[model samples]
Target: MHDSSVFLIEFGAIILGLGLLGRLAGRLRFSPIPLYLLAGLAFGEGGLYPLGTSEEFVAIGAEIGVVLLLLMLGLEYTASDLVSNLKTQYPAGLVDAALNALPGAAMALLLGWGPVAAVVLAGVTWISSSGVIAKVLGDLGRLGNRETPVILSILVLEDLSMAVYLPIITALLAGVGLAAGSLTLAVALGVAGLVLLIAVRYGRHISRFVSSDDSEKLLLVVLGLTLLVAGIAQKLQVSAAVGAFLVGIALSGEVAEGAHHLLAPLRDLFAAVFFVFFGLHTDPSSIPPVLLPALALAFVTTLTKIATGYWAAKRAGISARGRWRAGGTLVARGEFSIVIAGLAVTAGIEPSLGPLATAYVLILVILGPLTARYTEPLARRLTRRPRPEQPLAPPAQATPVDDQDTVGRT
Candidate 1:
């Protein structure tokens, strides 16, 4: 009874705090993400106070949060959309990887955390926050812009890459031998490929299985299936997030639409818990020591992300303004960055990684919206060249017709 009381008190406080923080963010026209992280820091270890009983529940909720995030993201596009984007926008995806991923890898290695940490950090830096970007686009009314599709295509490619990247990272973190790791990776890939094929070829049948006329029944059925698939994927050395994503992709039509609408509120709630949960694990005091490096990394990656967006938009033949907008829009990294860092933190790969990632994400999430709003104007202001002044044109004369008439008469 005593432990249960404490759990209720703590968990209740967490939910209430998240609600208030979200309201505050809405009022301030800011993303609640950084505030949620700060709240977690305040209530987590090495902060003002710590929860005694709710941590376990928060952790479970956090995992669910990640699954829902990827799942909703997958619902935004169809299986056909994924294949089309992969085929057409692959060059941009490659450029996104090369330009953005290397900075984090270099930072990790430079810090003497070695190769595994390098790989983890590379992912942290590489993927942009699709959630954040989507929200910003909606907020700023950029959904209809010429470069928006280009941006969406690039984001789709990144999410697809994760279907492969997460499994390999899972194998690496497991500390298996080379052959074992290769086998694990092969299994993971095979599973993912098979899921995709199923989604593409038999998606309608899959949707029919989960489809229900009632929202309550549909929610329970879809949620249960997602959790089941995610658990099985984790057991098979695959990414639970990826499994959830594939499940989402397999459903289409009214079922997908209904699932998205019904599940959005739940997704938001759990996702907030997840961000706070990440913060709870990271020690606030540790963040200060790595704050400088995190800022530097954030600065460098902001430019790299911008460069990536610009190149992609230009390739798609976007106008200068649209290209600049695209680059700026991609600057912010949020949930996925934390997800990647969370994996490293859980594996005890580098003690400083959690703090560094926390600080890095906090910096960019705040800066991301501002840049998205201002980048085009800022770029135009900075790179614009003044035109030379021209000589004044001679005043028009009215005597020419009269002169011709006089000469003819003479």
Candidate 2:
């Protein structure tokens, strides 16, 4: 067979398979991410039917997938929204970092992976998938709940934090000197602040500059601009994903909406490819050895995330049930986790990190929805058990649940 023919067949099969997996996940009311990852494993280096001709193409698609994921995420918030959430929710963000990130870092140290791997692992655990959480909230019809804002505020903080965090990891993974890494960090912070300033003050101008009546033109311009910025950011050692996100933030109004509509399909395609690419590089055989550790990590982090959400919601004066729901909703970790681990895996920082991350993510992403739906109910049920010894008190008047500040549904 000609190499071109082989490439066409291989890539076509992968796409078709991803579409089917996505449909299956939809029918099951679950995220398609785990299925995509599993498919990648089935076609990976140590698994069945590895591709010979299309791996390079897949790798390129995967990089674009990461950029698109971050870009779309940034589009979900305006600069004003970010500032508001930051003011109201900085404490939750702090607790989130302390609870979820610390465990991963501790695990890395326990495994003797050193400081760089520890930093990378901390990030892998720190971020919850905004993509997954948003879907679950919509599916569960809890978007209008009082605690929803609390959940979103934390997610926004995480997304913004990546603008700074990605550069630090990049420098560490590349084994740059302290001075060079400090310079890179400074540049990243400066860029992030400048972009935020531009987004807040000149977002309308940017949108107008990028806007087009023609759909094709709009798509082309937005995609081209994202890739160009991403490339330059990578050249500057500032992380391509951050550049793409900043671009997304800088655009507003009609341009942001049009770009989102035009780019969503591409984002889905590339994001699926990105997950597959992560799975493709991981040796399936390596996963078994790490499965127990991954399960343990997932369990511990799940509890920590719940605590983070609960504390944040309680602080916001949400109802008990809403607080539990908020905690449960934030338990899933998806795209960002893989992206973080993928970087370290590519750098050969630790051989076991990839497989461990794969196993951990698989457990949590699947578990995330269940927790979101049932956490409040389960907590209620447990507390409602009748005590045999105490005399039953007269039932108190039922208090009306007032979910105030119920704005921002879409």
Task: Report the lDDT tens digits of candidate 2 across residue range 279-378.
Answer: 9999899999999889989999999999999999999888788889999999999999999999999999999999999999999999999999999899
**Model 1 lDDT, residue 239, Cα:** 85
Q: Write the per-residue lDDT of candidate 1 for residues 1-410, one digit (tens) a residue.
A: 34888889889989999999999998988789999999989988898998778888899999999999988988888899998998899999999999989999999999999999999999999999998898899998787777889889999999989988998888888887899888878887898789888889999998999999999999999999999999999898888999999888888989999999999999999999999999998999999889998999999999998998899999987878888899999998899999989988889989999999999999999999998999999999999999887698678687543221111222
Give the TM-score (vs. native) of candidate 2. Answer: 0.95
Which of the numbered candidates is closest to the native, going by highest TM-score? 2
lDDT of each: 0.90, 0.93
Query: Where is model 1 poorest over a 10-residue stretch in terms of lDDT?
Result: 401-410
Candidate 2: how many backbone clashes?
0
Which ranges in model 1 have alpha carbons more than 4 Å from their true place? 393-410
